[model samples]
Target chain A: MTVQEKSWKEIPPAGICWKPSTEYLTGDWKTYKPIMDSEKCTRCTLCVIFCPDGAIHWNPGKEDIEFDYDFCKGCGICANECPTKAIEMKLE
Target chain B: MFSEWKFTAKDIAEKADLFMSGHRACAGCAAATVMRLVLKAVRGPIIATSATGCMEVVSSIYPYTSWATPWIHTAFENVAANASGIEAALKILKKKGRIKQQRIDVIAFAGDGGTYDIGIQALSGAVERGHDFLYVLYDNEAYMNTGIQRSGGTPHGASTTTSPAGTVIPGKVQYKKPIADIMVAHDMPYVATASPHYWRDLITKARKGIEVDGPAFLHTFAPCPRGWRSDPSKSIEISRIAVETCIFPLWEAINGEYQLSAPSKVIALRPERKKPVREYLKMQGRFRHLFTPKFEKIIDEIQQLTDKRWQRLLKKCGIV
Candidate 1:
């Protein structure tokens, strides 16, 4: 009813998608963040490789991994996949 | 927890998401998980053709869509053909100079029911015609959206709604369709079987599948917790057990050369480290009936079949 009530000029062009994929972020849905124990981290970058959300990155200067909490869903997959158990997920 | 793997979680986290979240997939759904992994393989523009299944329903309801990239929801039986059409149109556009950018990777996603049954003919035609595209089948082993009806890809001894385990029948007694092997016989450049638990291997295969010149088929093990009667969170864990027990192996045939992926490769290397089949069988409720004394022979049959299947795979890969 709301859509039909709109004026002719108010309606968007047909066959057009207004919202794109970038608008959908999952930061609010996460419950944890993976914290890497740098001392045990082998720099294998498995954490960077398996993070589905691209929430982790390599600190080029420090040569350690860093987490971008904005995109991290805290799936704990990084902690699970970490070979040395160097990464542990902390509750958000 | 033990294997020689190169990439880390850090590496995967650095890549941007092409398959966005907020989709309506089941919690811990393996299909949705694999979708994310496969999307990571393609960094550039992609056009995906999704069949009418869980992904289509969950991702593309009335007002919203979960796909970050452009996607089309095709019919239940003609997804491959639809994808092939898109591939052809793209090539034509490139030839006519109407499109002046990099080649767009066209991918078709389907469930096991769409792939191993209704869509097989269209799939065969597309692959046989030498279309350059990747067809990924997220095989959850049944028609989950329609209340778990038995499909052609359903494994032997698994009970579904249509093939219920009753006094007269044990379950769906037919073997799984050899999709990966059959695709390889099509002589496509790449054919792989992957699992969501093995993201590194799956990602690599997805990239290879897209890069190949002709049709590439990827059969991914999508664990349906609801259908399988397992804890939703156990999707990845149960899949890991499936591979460790050599029941759902991770393998790929690149240019006709078969190779076992991680965990499977590790397990196959050690002769004395074979995991017990019961460990995997006990996790899923569909296989629960097999544990009873009356069904011990069925259990034995399953185990024997698993061993024989692994042996056959090893022989094909030249490990034997």
Candidate 2:
């Protein structure tokens, strides 16, 4: 039997859903992407430490982490934690 | 067309109105307020499993009515267990297309007696099993439903039928159980402690907890006006004082990182903390024991412990 057939129930909805917004730290979904400044990159990993959700990432080859918007709560931990000022909490 | 409090008249009527009027809950029951706030966030067709306590007895008197949502009144120790069964069944039924989306969330409500003492093991088991549900403990610091006996959540010097103050024995020998700490130990996805005095905070925390992946626990300080023998209106004020005094800190733990949500500073910085504990204790009959010198020492110890915790929180939050 298929997963659905075997369980006789639908798959549960993924845990968190994001609501978009505007304003400086309002976390508007469409207006912004969590941008990282590669020039000041230290790859020190403090940004990842502060992220409420595990959305911030570090790429060893590119020498910087990326923010995954799908799961990010937009709590701005990364920007607050960036030691080199590489992560600025952009408007979104 | 008008608004009473924040809820529009239409909002009150049109919403589930789950905690209906004319129940036997004592005048100014804080747990009822908790239920009202909880209903605001969780739309039905939902199921609530309530353990036997003031809320259960008062709201669900056999035959006389109260709850608007589908609810199961279970033993004092089985609220979480029953809720888990409901949630598990709903999941299976939903996969088979037997239930609808609104029917997905099941909530378990318990009192301090149920949550901190009797029902703790069952709650821990269900949470560890990773059930998709929410457990709300309306803590009044004692078993108010059963003649105001001391439960695990009773404050240090609070007089209860069980731990009454006298010449030799002091009131409520043990400090309140750290329920949030216990839940955090389970590594649940979301855990929060909120008070009805903070409506927005309470609602936000409940919504977030429900939205999380696994079992989420919310421990709420629902002051018992009768059991506390305080003016009903002061329930909110007393709870607010508790938070300000760091006697009850409003915080949340998600995946083990603690976030200090209220005050954000040590009690010393908040002028309210300067208010004598007498302001809080004088309002409650439970603390009437403070009249004696022997019992007064417990009050001092409680204050010192609260100050220490507040200082630690401030230092950790870098607010000190």
Candidate 3:
């Protein structure tokens, strides 16, 4: 349902759905991108657990967590919290 | 103990996007930052409800919302009541085989005006009934959306539009309502105070609150640059200073068992760790009127109050 609809019911205008806010690409707000190197990774998942935003996806298929740059705001919490310094911020 | 606190900006960025950017929150608003941090821990489908306030007004407007999960903007008061109804409906829908809504988190978000004042009755009723939901109070210390009117959560001696500092009076004459303590007094399963600067602690407490089988209340310290007349970029820094100064002590209660957070625990262990309150008070324009020598007494009074509260908290944590 469009939120543009004048009525207050759930329509596109309301933008209320079971899905999350995945459509908004917030990467432009960041001046840096966190680059994760799996070779030095510990996989404790602390970064994943502690990330204020759900930008890290635990890709068991890749045997490491992956970052969707589209969502990361480059707050650097993950890089700072990484026990082994596996995640590094690369300037855009 | 400060050395033990782990989560940093990077750890938090990994879990981004429950509340995305491109929305209308003023730059560097602590309330918006607090919302991002709190929304990080929902591991599954969640339904969030916000009471009318800055968060409700700024984040969700018609045809656009920052929320990625299902959200409902309820009226100013009775947010908890609406959440309770949602929780009940979830159970009934599941019972009737209408919807498999299992594991869906039901959360209510509100500002101090909605929580400590307008919504207090509904909050009390919802908690008393043992509704399974989490209530997050993003307290920015005043009615910031309506131009910085003093609120029940406003700290003592801080100036606001309503509590203007002048020759007749210093600022707000009364102390904060101890809203979190009142929530604890309700005999709930969990209650905690958090700040966005302590991202790890804040996130863990929120996750615990939402995951609990019954009611959980999280009183977050949200600093408002506009309301405080402070620097916008220092939003996180302001919360950091509040914790460091022991003015906004962080602690949690689980089934009546109280434990001070790491930083506060350090202060409890070593009273010497407490910083003077002037740095915090002087940084905000709301407290600017008290900077003069004539108002020095008010600063001392505030310092005394902070020490007393810290001592009281230490005693409860059994660290004294």
Candidate 4:
């Protein structure tokens, strides 16, 4: 997570990004967290499709949806768009 | 109709993540979803170029990039131009046996400000030259990246920083420019308007746009919670209500032949299915002033305009 300062001559031209953005944890921005109710879940995937952050994932081993809280900013879109009301947004 | 191209949740989950998370987009940014769906639809090697806008700014910070695929960041007015060059170079490289891939989709992502106004000339020139690429315009209705300034895609009554709703003026004075129809006039192989709410349709159109031989244009409606002054969670609902109210209809034109998409087709066939413009307007804070008694007439005007445009589109699609 530390940003290493490189010499000006060592930097690549055109401001190239050598690393992927996954290192940045965006979960701190959330004021609310979405908790999924597996009992009422239909696995219709509406929440997965509408999630702006791509934080919701279909776990094949467990055969259920999992939330990656590291990237989930807790927009509540999954909670709002869930047909079965399986996802509830709770204050973090 | 697009059942064959429909993507199940598993199918989408199985696809390689092209647009990664941990970028700087807002909590409920619809444009981010648009980018994700588009890359998912392409499902192949892609060389993406983006104009300077919200998505570009958010995805490509100095030290990191959200795009897993090869991406180039260009200036505000030359994303299409950049894509055109990339496609031409790839073609040459393939001819010289330098590249191994059979086909590499070139996609240019731009916001409404870049597509409708600043970069229109470059886009027009690139498409007119018959470049093999897909130009995806994610229209959030205004210049949202630069603090909600007005753009050509801003609707007639939506207020912005540049076009404030006041005693003299009622938000933006001009209607949204028909950028999709303008591209259709170029006689490209594919042209379509989509919203993130209709993810299936949007992905389908994106696939077709990429697979086409000549240039293609996809005008996507992306709801901005910050600029629109609405709930971040309601972005999908706002996009859905937009189509239901006929404010932003889903349709496609193939070689200048217009046809309504499924959602709009239902409304075109059964007029009663169409919701009032008020329902759509009431959701966004940008149009809050229009609900006041002084601006009540503007709402009626908007409704009349919506109905008129819907009828015209139906006639064009030969559904009337």
Ten-residue stretch with the least lDDT total in model 1 chain B: B1-10
**Which 10 residues in a row give candidate 4 chain B its minimum summed lDDT?**
B1-10
What value does the lDDT take at residue B18 in candidate 2?
A: 61
When 2 and 4 are scored with lDDT, the better candidate is: 4
- lDDT tens digits, residues B102-179, model 1? 779999999998999999999999999999999999999999998999998888888899988877667888888888
Query: Candidate 3 chain B TM?
Result: 0.95
* Candidate 4: Cα lDDT at B129: 91
Q: Per-residue lDDT for B5-106 in model 3, tens only?
A: 245444555554677654555544678767877887776788999999998887665445678677888988989999999999998888899986567889
The DockQ leader among the candidates is 4
**What DockQ do the predictions score, one after another?**
0.22, 0.01, 0.13, 0.79
- Please identify which of the two predictions, 2 or 3, would achieve the higher TM-score against the true structure: 3
What's the residue-level lDDT of B63 in candidate 2? Answer: 38
lDDT of 3 at A8: 50
C-alpha displacement of B130 in model 2, angstroms?
0.6
- Please provide TM-scores, in order, for all candidate models, with all chains considered together: 0.83, 0.71, 0.80, 0.97
Better of 1 and 3 by TM-score: 1
Tens digits of lDDT, candidate 1, A1-92? 02443454764665333444334455666776677888998888765654444456677678777877755666665776677999886887
Question: Chain B alone, TM-score of each model?
Answer: 0.96, 0.90, 0.95, 0.98
Clashes (N, CA, C under 3 Å) per candidate: 20, 11, 31, 0
Put down candidate 2 lDDT per residue, B188-259, tens digits, no spaces: 888888976665678778777777778999988887787888865456667777776567778888887777
lDDT of each: 0.80, 0.69, 0.80, 0.90
Candidate 1: where is the Cα deviation over 4 Å?
A1-92, B1-8
